[model samples]
Target: MREIQYEEFEEKIIEIRRTSKVTKGGKNLSFRVVAIVGNKNGKVGLGIGKAREVPEAIRKAIADAKKNVIEVPIINGTIPHEVIGRQDASKVLLRPAAPGTGIIAGGTVRAVVELAGIQNILTKALGSTNPLNLAMATINGLKELLDPRKVAKLRDITVEEVYKGVRREGNA
Candidate 1:
């Protein structure tokens, strides 16, 4: 059996709802959990799970999140560029911000960014604010991030040249 690491115990439970289904005998109650998982280092995941008990539901959600973790590229403490992501009816707009901007995101996006160890970012929720959808959208946005190093390699330029251009522009 695969052992569960102690670190996996850490997770943010975004939302929990008790859902019931009517049956011939009466009603069956179930719990739904939405969770965000991250290593606080530009890797994050979101998961949703349903179970008869709240703890079990959360556990399942966390496991799913770990299995789905995505690596988000970070540059100068922020994303390399702006990105838009959508999941179902939820849309999220993510923009890279200068350092010290301090994560100007709301709700689920904020939690995701913080856990992903992003120090500066701007985000807007364009559609449904449902926690689950928002979380998933944020993850999708992060998945699309491209690092400056990768961009520099693609453009056949040194990373230092990229920063030098910005510095020159600031001084001018």
Candidate 2:
């Protein structure tokens, strides 16, 4: 993992909803913000924050996001493999694309992927279309990515063997 300063991360506000609560004191209004943060170098995070003001809510969200950062394995500006991530009813399918393909995705998915330093990718959002859910699903899918070296080590094989799809004589 690369050690980066907090200021190096890029932040995007996915959604902001004004919520109200009915109580003895008439109604209480608050703003809820969904935030995505990334360093564009394989690290990203998602967060939600609520407050009476938008700026404060955004600040809180950014802070929360920084705390939940996850590392993504990016290869040649794309993901290592395909994956599907789920959050509630939202499902995000992430596929690696050839170089120069750019990012083909919806607004929410694009923000997350671009911030994660992915220049080429394809994404499909399934089920719920809610911005918060979609963002979470994208992050979840990225979190599921596996590095080739790690996979090879776990399987007791060389990295080249993992890519070549060659099986040992004794192994299935």
Candidate 3:
């Protein structure tokens, strides 16, 4: 794991929703913010925080996300294979891409992938389009990645052996 500091990570607010509570005193208004924090080095997290104020909610969200940070397997600035993640009704599909393909994702998926330092990849959202669900699903997909070296060790083979015939010139 690389050294991570809160100051070093970039932050983005994915979505914000407001709620009003009915009380004897009148109505209590609160903001719920879906926030993402990433070091752009394969470490990223997603958080949801609710507060009476937006900035406070964002701050809390960032702190909460830091506690839930996860490291993704990044090879050549992309993932090792195609993966899918589901959270509630949301499903996110992620696939590795060539170096120059850039990030091919929408709002929620884009934010999550960008923070994970994934520069070349493709993504598709299925089922739910809700930002919170999508973000969680994206994180879940990243959580499932296994490094090639680790897989090779587990299989009692070398990395090249594990990937034999998988790489070809202009195959990206």
Which prediction has the highest lDDT against the true structure? 2
lDDT of each: 0.85, 0.94, 0.92
User: Which runs in model 1 stand beyond 4 Å of their true positions?
Assistant: 1-9, 160-172
Model 2, range 1-172, lDDT digits (tens) per residue?
9874675899999999999999997999999999999989998899999999999999999999998999999989999889999999999999999999999999999999999999999999999999999999999999899999899999999988987999999898
TM-score, structure 2 vs. true? 0.94
What clash count goes with each model? 0, 0, 0
Lowest lDDT 10-mer window, candidate 1? 163-172
Residue-level error in angstroms, candidate 3, position 136 = 0.1
After superposing candidate 2 on the true structure, give the runs of residues whose Cα lies further than 4 Å from its correct spot. Answer: 1-7
Candidate 3 residue lDDT tens string, 1-172: 8775664889999999998999999999999999999999989999989999999999999888987899899999999989998999999999999999999999999999999999999999999999999999999999999999999899666788666835445645
Task: Supply candidate 2's per-residue lDDT for 120.
Answer: 97
The CA lDDT at 116 in model 3 is 90
TM-score between candidate 1 and the true structure: 0.85
In candidate 1, which residue pairs clash? none
lDDT of 2 at 161: 94
Residue 91 in model 3: shift from native, Å? 0.2
